[model samples]
Target: MSPLPGPRARGHRLPMVTALLLALVGTLGLTGCASLGTAAKYDGGRLRIDGTDLSFRLPEGWERRDNEELADALAGSEIDDELAERGGISSSQQDAILDEVVLFAVGPGGSSLNVLTSSEALPPRAVLIDQVESFGGTDVRETDFPTDVGDSFAVAYRLDAQGVQADLLAMVIDTGDRLSVITVTTGSRAETDRVAEVIRTSLALR
Candidate 1:
């Protein structure tokens, strides 16, 4: 060969090619890592519901609506009117209808509540738990109630409704003076847990 193409020319070209390849590899690796991390955080199409800082990841193509307006509209309504307006169906036809559901924490008492209108009244806790277990595809977990709030309890369950299954967790805190409840509903158990965890972590007994 003619001086092996000259060391100066070959060496410079080789190092530049090597550096470009390394940079490309690094870029690809970073992109893959980011994708994996997002997938890991996704948690099967769920969203977290924090107090005021509600944050969670929803499933692709799923529509989410905030009912803050409805909450404000329905606040302090007697149960009958509340149910009627919420269901938007004749009382007789309310059976098994999965109406728009509302989850809210009332006050310092931390008594979580879920309000839904159905033709038939929901069963008691035991029966509700059984129904939830059947639909949620997971065992129900009961959490300890605060001692200060006697006879109040908190429970979390998974639910399948409207072709989508999600996690619904509620905390019922009843202080004799007042009742406060906090509830979080999410598209997945993981999302529900994340929201509930954040609420629990940031809870202030005002």
Candidate 2:
């Protein structure tokens, strides 16, 4: 058995893990994501998303995905193949499910964030626990993860058996009327902190 990851490998924080996701934001491009309604643009100095109340601007160096075919956009990245190889998870299956929930994505693939809305309503913590386990998560820890998303039940963990042995940060934000999931995965533990910070400040509720 391998040794558990140190604190740095654990992650910073975010919303919640769902199906363990990614795709480089760079490959997708700001121009490609420049569609009319769903793109992440500062409206009156606030970043807004089309389908959800959640909003958060990407970090200075980050890119936003405006594409409707989120999974296909992600398919252009290497993270899925890594997940498949390590966790025995299927990329096509993951993509199919993601296509349904993905509202916006950030990053350049190796490290990234995905925001998806769900109405599954199985209890926030329960849903969070189950999804992490499903994605082969390990070393799970509850987090205060820094977010404006409101009393989020967040967690950080190693994406066990997947993604080049990377870290994952997830959050489950429940607004009584809706639930928004923020999922991030990286090729290294180091990326987790930065991505989590992105999630923390990303929400721009409409």
Candidate 3:
């Protein structure tokens, strides 16, 4: 594993998943239209997150929730060292822009699936996985795979946070104008592998 890069002005050094959740919760009050107004449609068991052209099948038994609902649930929680100096603006200020972020979250029982898009371009895969593990994820393994859209970067890891031990499959896909981080969280590695294949096959740009 590479050394954990020092914190950047945009806090790129923070794990993408952890950093984004905290940032979203903090800025929810400042956003009205962008955070709550973005459109997502579900048709034929597939969900299309508007603006990002991210569409994928909703895994068996999984249900989708809007990002604003997530922000509301997580608003009171505080995360340390994750939001340091994001764009040299106050964490709350940086979070205010989260209205522009696109997020799709699904879960079945104790597992979850997330698709997120932001204007910020992410670093390459290796660096991204390292950053995630550094932020309390363990047993990280990189999985390179092919997708209909293009080359895909994926990582399998276990995250123990808030008393939950979540097995996660994280994939990064660059869509020219934004970066999409798709994560599948479950208790079984077999399940993660199975779902990862479905996501890669289904992903495409519109």
TM-score of each: 0.38, 0.62, 0.68
The worst-scoring run of ten residues by lDDT in candidate 2 lies at: 7-16
lDDT of model 1, residue 192:
56
- In candidate 2, how many Å is residue 159 off? 1.8
Which has the better TM-score: candidate 1, or candidate 3?
A: 3
Identify the superior model by TM-score, candidate 2 or candidate 3.
Answer: 3
What is the overall TM-score of model 3 with all chains considered together?
0.68
- Candidate 2 lDDT, tens digit per residue, 1-206? 99974432222112233335432222222224412234365233444544567666555555555546464555555545654553344766555455655555555443556666655442446556665666566787777755565557677777533213556676667554456666666665567667677657756567
- TM-score attained by model 2: 0.62
CA deviation > 4 Å runs, candidate 2:
1-18, 21-46, 68-70, 73-95, 146-149, 160-163
* True-structure RMSD for candidate 1: 27.6
Q: Which of the predicted structures, 1 or 3, would earn the higher lDDT when compared with the native?
A: 3
Top model number, lDDT: 3
lDDT of each: 0.36, 0.53, 0.56
- Please provide the root mean square deviation of candidate 2 (C-alpha atoms, Å): 11.5
Runs of candidate 3 with Cα error greater than 4 angstroms are: 1-43, 77-101, 120-122
Tens digit of per-residue lDDT, candidate 3, span 1-206: 99985433343443364443432232321222113333344443766656676677765555555767554444443432233332334556545534444554444444556566655555676676666655566798888766776446787777654344556777877665656677776666787788788777777666
